[model samples]
Target: MRTITLCSGKGGVGKTLLATSLGRIIQRQEKCNVLLVDLDLSVRGLTLLAFQNKYELDRLPFSLTDYFYLEDEDQPALLHDLHKGLAQNNSNAEESQETTAQATAGPSPYERLDGLFILPSSTESERPDWTPLHHLELNETIDKLGKLYEFATSSLHVDYVIFDTQAGLGSLSLAATTLSDMNLIVLEEDDISWRTALNALMEISALNKRLQQKSHSYFLANKVSSSMLDTADKLKAFSFLPPIPFDAWVQKLFAHATTAVLEKDFEQSDFFKQVESRVWQELAVILGARQRTTGNGPRSSWWRG
Candidate 1:
């Protein structure tokens, strides 16, 4: 399975939203199973958005947090439990005599959309204890995450694994980068965002060089305005995806909507249209979901030094 990670130097750049929306789009277009993994243990943004129902969130049998702390021998059992729990919940939901409105509202956060599944970061009611993660060595964390990736791709039979990683160059984010086939470094037009994004790019480049891996990394300018497009294009020596323009409607919708992508209005919004039309096409090419002609093949390798 192909892997992609949406990472940023700081929070609030819309990584979780992009991850979820991209998974839905890919699943719908490719007719394949796509897993959306929340690797951001600190805030659990994707978890909150995906598991809108508190009952379901509390009922989750396992999460990335639990997987990280468990012994290697026991990891497989947790994954099995997770699969069983999801299957049982989905089966029960299907049998309910709920109204058509409720039924058509959209898939439950567990399986938010058909062929789209989410792996939450944690199931804890309160703040998760991150002390355990802090103690693990960097390589150890990557090894554990690699095993999780293998289970999702091989056993779960998912075609793609998209990670919504914690902001910044933290251990988990770095590890996710190492495992990803492509890393989308999302940023805005602000000074801090630009500087931090540059730092993040350098870190990823250094990491790839040290490991002798050629994982592609690209810049994605989100919430851009007409005036910002010129500035975004001025970034030196980095490949860029089509910029997703700022949308006032979406900004207001996020205030009340549990998950924007599931909302009917979002489908009509420019942000959604741009992602569906522009961003995914570029991503499909980079992820090998689509073929690149000989003339354009070198574009994929431009990310490397």
Candidate 2:
């Protein structure tokens, strides 16, 4: 399985939105099982998005917080429980009366997505106790998470494991970055966003160098305006995702905590279509879902150029 983490240097830059949308895209296009883990302990936005009109956090039986504090020997059991819970939930949802094609019919880009699941962080966990790195040694926390990753990929058999991590270069964020196979640093089109994102990109680079592990990394510029695309294009050295332009419709969805990718007419929208054309294509290439031609023959790579 391929593991990707979406992180940023600053909050409110749309990392969770990108992670959710990208997960939907990967699940639909690749026809694979995708697991999204929200590691943004301070803000549980993914949880809010997933169960927005369905269930509230207080009603859920468990959350990722339970896994974080478990002993190493005990974590595997918690992981298994989470996996089983999700499987049961998916099965139950499928057994629910199916909506006719007409009911679901839409040009929505993500309407066809399936086999996607989200494990949201616990709202019960206080902010003071959120960062595992602060409570434990960084290397120890990284090792524990690495082992969890191994179990998820090997035993769970998920095709894609995407993590929505907290912003900044905090210890947890750094550990998550180290554990991820690919890191997507998200930012907006403004100068503050650029400045913060540059710092994030450099931190990732330095961490990779220190770890001596080469994982694919890229910068995603969001909320781009038509006038800013030219200026955005001038940002050097890093690969980019298809910049999501500022749209009033998107703002409304965000305000309502709605999943725009799953909404009607998403396929007909320029924003999501651009996402498919640019981000999906790049993701496919990175995850080996598509073959790349080279002098040696067709091969797969995480590098986007």
Candidate 3:
């Protein structure tokens, strides 16, 4: 499975919104098993956008925290079992819940979104005691998370796993970056946002080298106010970085609980046009997705997200 992470060095740049929207589009259009996992310890609310229903999974049975504490067995086995439990929980709920926050159906491998699944950070009420995640412990925990990601793709047959990373440069964000095959950064165009995002981009570049990882990542300039587009001519980053304008209609999708996917005129709005095309283009590069493009095009390689 290919893992894509959306991260920013700072918060409130609409990272979750972008991740959820991309998750929906990729799951529906690509016909791939998509798991939208939220690794934010502060607020694991990405599911609210899609799975508004109560995720009543007992906190004891499984959680990412458990894997962090129980350093007994090999990490792969522990995470594999946890993933299975989550899948079973969704599968059981499938019959009753016809429509999920994203797709109408239960939460199984075969649930509403054929090729999508989401493993949030923790369904538990309180955050796990991160005391155990010391320097060595943190490194090991990330190693396990990375292994879990590989398991999701190879053994479990998931097509894509998108991560809603914590809103900062921390251990969790580092873990997400380390495990990701491709990364995307969603940021605004304001001066402050750009400064913060530049720091994030440098971090992503350093991350790629540190892990000996190879992934094509990009930044999505979100809510591109007229000022940002005007600055594109000056800043090199803004030129190729896909810019998405503000759309009130798309904003409404997140305002309420579950969206009426069928009734929602996503096609009518221009929100999906530029952003969606760029997403597809980025996906193609990351996944080696075949496409007929103009020959002798510029070499495609990116270290920044």
What lDDT would each prediction earn against the true structure?
A: 0.78, 0.66, 0.60
How many pairs collide in each candidate, listed in order?
0, 0, 11
Candidate numbers sorted by lDDT from highest down = 1, 2, 3
- Of candidate 1, the 10-residue stretch with the lowest lDDT total is 93-102
Q: Which tens-of-lDDT digit does each residue in 70-163 have in candidate 3?
A: 6666565665555454445443223323222323233443233445555655555544554423343457657767766665444335666788
The pairs that clash in candidate 2 are none
lDDT of 1 by residue, 26-115 (tens): 888998878889998878889988877777788777898898878888987897666554444343322323322233333434577777
Cα-lDDT of candidate 2: 0.66
TM-score of each: 0.85, 0.78, 0.75
Question: What are the runs in model 1 whose C-alpha is more than 4 Å off?
Answer: 71-76, 83-109, 128-132, 230-237, 292-298
What TM-score does structure 2 among the candidates reach? 0.78
Per-residue lDDT of candidate 2, residues 1-305 (tens digit): 68888888878888887787778778778777788887765677776667554434454544666666767688756765544444342422223232121123222111124577677677442355445434556777678667666755443347788889888866667778887778888888667778888798888788778888777777888878889877666552346655667666667766764655565555666666667777767666766678644334323333422
Give residue 139's lDDT in candidate 2 (0 to 100).
Answer: 76
> How much does candidate 1 score in TM-score?
0.85
Please tell me which model should have the higher TM-score, number 2 or number 3: 2
Candidate that scores best on lDDT: 1
Query: What residue pairs clash in candidate 1, if any at all?
Result: none
Those runs of model 2 whose alpha carbons end farther than 4 Å from true positions after fitting are: 53-56, 59-61, 71-77, 87-113, 123-136, 234-238, 259-261, 264-268, 292-305
